[model samples]
Target: RAYRMTETRGIIHRRVQSIIFVLIATACFLAVSVLLVFAPLLGRLAEAHLEWIKPYMGTITIWRYIIASTVIVIGLFSVHIWLPAGKRRFVSIIPGIVFTLVAWLVGS
Candidate 1:
């Protein structure tokens, strides 16, 4: 009974660690994406002297979409791979991730 309890505790500990890792990874990915993809667009809009609301109305470029899509795909991939309680194969998760991206694109 004691051995079983210790093993259960170990599993729970590892699960908690994986969850924290996934959260931090996702946050970092989003931060970098925003900095690299949106920062310049915002800077350009600021220089245009547009009104506060109009700045947000600035045209979004294809690069932004590409970067955002990449970030989302990566984030989803990490979550699908890491957050589950049991181990998953990388190949198995690809289809779900791709389907999710396609669904999001179509919905948007």
Candidate 2:
């Protein structure tokens, strides 16, 4: 029963996740990746205001959390809705890539 549910979800989710996953993943990655990409720029700012910004530094560092949360919530909800019973789930890169490309094109 569990296995069946997961397969049903895969069938349904593959399509939807393909449509929106990439855009959201890109958005999420961009949010976190930018900071790492521009670490030198942040270093400059940090030097100028270490004492004040120190407290919120951790929070400010992870804008990508929003993207991650959004994706997880949407993906889980989608699975719950679309999946049948008796199915379990697994993860693989091909599905991820397909989903990303679809999401990139369809989401825009």
Candidate 3:
């Protein structure tokens, strides 16, 4: 009976771990999804900040947007790796690229 109880506990632990991992991955996916959907707005915000500092900066810091987009893309890729295969994995890249493009266009 004790052995059986131990085995059951171990199994439950594994299942709980899996559920937690999946939940975290889903949250990441949702976050990136929202970020992609609002990328244009984010771009506008970045642009506005740039405009505010243009005088002191003396030129547009295009590199800032490039770097930011790069970081966002890296995060998207990280989450993509955690997502299960099929449609979820395939669709993950689209928004990341769009976000990058929007950042570049709006920043410039």
Instruction: Name the top TM-score candidate.
Output: 1
> What CA root-mean-square deviation does each model show from the true structure?
7.8, 9.6, 11.8
lDDT of 2 by residue, 32-67 (tens): 455555654785589587877777666765654455
Model 1 TM-score is 0.52
Q: Which stretches of candidate 2 lie over 4 Å from their true place?
A: 1-6, 9-13, 45-108
In candidate 2, clashing pairs total 17
Ranking by TM-score: 1, 2, 3
lDDT, candidate 2, equals 0.55
**Positional deviation of residue 50's Cα in model 3 after best superposition, in angstroms:** 7.7
| Model 2 poorest 10 in a row by lDDT | 84-93
Best by lDDT: 1
User: Candidate 1 local accuracy as lDDT?
Assistant: 0.68
Write one digit per residue (lDDT tens) for candidate 1, span 4-108: 222333777887887798678778677766866677777676768755645444454455656666677777888787655566778988888888888977996
Each candidate's lDDT (Cα)?
0.68, 0.55, 0.55
RMSD of 1: 7.8
Model 1: per-residue Cα lDDT at residue 61 = 48
